[model samples]
Target chain A: MIQQLNDSTSEAIQQLNDSTKMFNLYLKLGFEHLLDLAAYDHLLFVIALTVVYQLAEWKKLLILVTAFTIGHSITLALAVLDVIQFPATIIEWLIPITILLTAAYNLWTLSATDGDSATQKTDLNIKYFAALFFGLIHGMGFSNFLKSALMPGEEQQIVWQLLAFNLGIEMGQLVIVGMVVLINFLVLNFLKVNKQNWIKIVNTLVMVFCIWIIGGLLE
Target chain B: MIFFLQILSLWLAHDIHLTKAQVDVNTSEQSVQVSMHIFLDDLEKVIQEETGFTEKMHLGTEKEVPEGDSLLAVYLRSHFLITANEEPLSFSFVGKENSQDLLAVWCYFEFPLSDISTKKLTLTNNVLMELYNDQQNIITLVGPNKKRDYLLFQVDEATASFSY
Candidate 1:
C-alpha cells in the first residue's frame, strides 16, 4: 500500500511538471500580440500618407513605401544584433518632428499652387527621403521594444522568438496598410468629395496633432 | 518664497544615518560586538524612569542574533532614526578594527540631529513615518517587541528617555 501511494505521488508530481512546461511554452508563443500592439505609430503615419494619395503618382508612392521598408528593415536587423543603440528620448522627439515636417511640406505646396496645372507639377521627392530617414528611427524604437520583451539569455530560443515577433510586426503593418488603401478607394469612388480639400484638412490636422505631441515631450 | 520655505523645512527636518560597516556570512569571525550610544538628552522622562536602574541593557530576548550579515542589517534598522520626505540621504558602512564592539552605529543627518522636531507617530496621530519597501509599496508595521529599546521624547518639556 505504501509503494502504491508513493507511485501515485510521483505521477502527480510529473503531471504538475508537464503543466508548468506547457504554460512556459504558451508564454513564449503568446508574445506575438505584444509585437502587433507596438505598431501604434503606423496609425498616424498612414493617416499622414492619406493626404498625399491624390497628389503622388502611383509609381512614386510605391518607391517611397519601399524605401521606408528597406531603411527600417536594415536598422531593425542591425539594432537587434547590438551593432547600434540610439537614445530613446531623441528618437521619441524626432518621430513627431518628422510628421510635422511632412505636414508643413504638404501645406506649403497646396498654398503656393493655384491651378490644377501648378498643383500637378509640385513634387514630393523631399518628403519621401524624410520618410526613409524617420523609418530608421522608428525601427530602432521597435528593436528596443523587442529587446526588453525577449530579455535574450544564452538560450537559442530567444533568437527564434525575436524573429517571430518581427514577422508579426510586418504582418500587422501590412494589414493596416491594406485597410487604409481599401478605405481610400471606397471614399474616392462613392463619396465624391474634392480630394484636394480633403488633403488640406487632413494635413492641417496632422500638423496640429504633431505639435501637441512635441509640446508633451518638451514638458 | 514657497520653494525656499520648503527647502528650509526639509533641511531642518530630515534624519539620515550613514553606514559604519558591513559583514558577509563567509567572512564573519566567530563573534562580533555591536554598540550604540544613546545620548541621555534625546530620551523622554518615562523611558529614563524605566531603564535607569541598569548601566547595560541587553534586549535580545529571543537569544537569536541574526546570522552573519543579517546582524548588520538588523542593527542599521534598529539604531537609525529617519522622518519621511525631508531630503535625500545616503549611507555608507565603513570597516574599522574596534576591540570593544563588533558593530558600531555613527549617524549624521543632513541637518543637525538636535534640530529634529518630535511629532507623535501613533496610527491615530497626524504625523507619522510611513516606511516603504524597495518596490515603493508601503511596509506594514508589526507589533513592537517589548525587548527592543525605544528612544522616547517629550517635545513640550524638551526631555527624552530610553526604555526597553
Candidate 2:
C-alpha cells in the first residue's frame, strides 16, 4: 500500500510540475513591467539639485543637466554590459554623499562672500559647475537604479526601458526645478524680506540631514 | 569607513542561503525529523573582484538595530517568501553549528502524514510537501536519515502546505 501511494504521489507531483512549467512559460512571454517606482536616491538627486540652485541660469543649467545625462547614460550602458560594476551597498552610500557634497559646496560659496551682488553672481556660476560635476556622480547613481530594473535575460528590452526611464527622470527633474524656482520667486524675491541669511541657514540644515542619511545608508 | 565596515560585517556574519534541498519519508510508528541546510555567504568578494571598484567609504555614525533581532530577519522577511499555509513563517537563527556555517530555522505545523517525498530544493526554486488535509492531526517521527535529511515534513491540516 505504501509503495503504491508513493508511486501515485510522484505521478501527481510530475503532472503539477508539467502544468506549472507551461504556466510559467506563458507568464515570461508577456510584457513584464520592469520599471518600479523610482528609487529614493533618484528622488533625492532631483531634490538636492532644486534646493541648491535658487537663482536659475537657464543656459548653464541646461549644459550641466546634459552633462549629467551623458555621464549616467555611459555608465549605465557600461555597467549593464558587465564592463563596470560596484558593490550595491557602496553605491547606496555614495548616492547620499553626492547630495551632501553638493549642499556643502552651496553653503561654502554662499558663506564665503558678503552681501555683494557681484559675489553672489560669481558664486552662482561656481554652483553651476559644481552641479555639473555632481550630476556625473548622480548619473552613476541613476544607472544603478536602472540596472536593477533591467534584468540579464531581458537584454533586448534594456535600450527601450533605459530611454523611457531617462526620459521620465528628465521630466521629474524639470518639474522639481520649476517648483523650486516658483517657490523662490514667490517667497524670497517677491516678498523681498532680505532672507539671504535664512536661505544659507536652510541649505546648511539640508546638508546636515544629507550627512545623517548617508551615515545611515553606510551602516 | 567604519560605517561601511559595519554594514559589510553584518552582511558577512549572517548566512544567506541561495539554494537548499530536502526529502522526507514516514511510517505510522516513527516521529517526524526535519533536516534542512541552506547555502549562504557574503558574495562581496566576488562582486568586488569582478567589479574593480571599492564600496563607498562611509564616515557616518552607526545605526542601531531598530528591533531586537539582527537586520537579517527583516531582510529575509521582505525579500524571501517563507510561509505556512497562507501566513508568513517566522524564522529564528539557530546559530552556526556542526562545521556547516549554516543557520538553521525551525517551525512546526499540525498535520499527520504516513510518508512524504520531495524533489531537490534550491533557493531559486523550492519544493514543499505537506501531508494530511484535516485539522488537529498529530505527527511524530524519529531521527532523520542523514543522507537525505534536508527535507522537512509537517502534518498539520490547518497549516500544512506545499509549493514548487
TM-score of every model versus the real structure: 0.45, 0.46
Just chain B of model 2: what TM-score? 0.26
- List each candidate's DockQ score: 0.02, 0.06
Reference-based lDDT, residue B124, model 1: 13
Which candidate leads in DockQ?
A: 2
Q: Give one digit per residue, the lDDT tens place, for model 1 in B1-164.
A: 96565334333321111111111111122111222222111211212333343232212213222341233333343333333234312323332222221122222111122222322122111011121111000111111221111121111211222211
TM-score: which candidate is best?
2
Once superposed on the true structure, which residue ranges of model 2 sit more than 4 Å away at CA? A1-40, A52-56, A111-128, A190-195, B1-164
Model 2 chain B: worst 10 consecutive residues (lDDT sum): B130-139
Q: Per-residue CA lDDT of candidate 2, range A88-136, in tens? A: 5565666677777766666666665566889877876766666666665
Which stretches in model 1 have alpha-carbon errors above 4 Å? A1-39, A54-59, A111-124, A154-159, B1-164
Best candidate, lDDT: 2
TM-score of decoy 1: 0.45
* TM (chain A) per model: 0.69, 0.67
* Candidate 2 vs. true structure, TM-score: 0.46
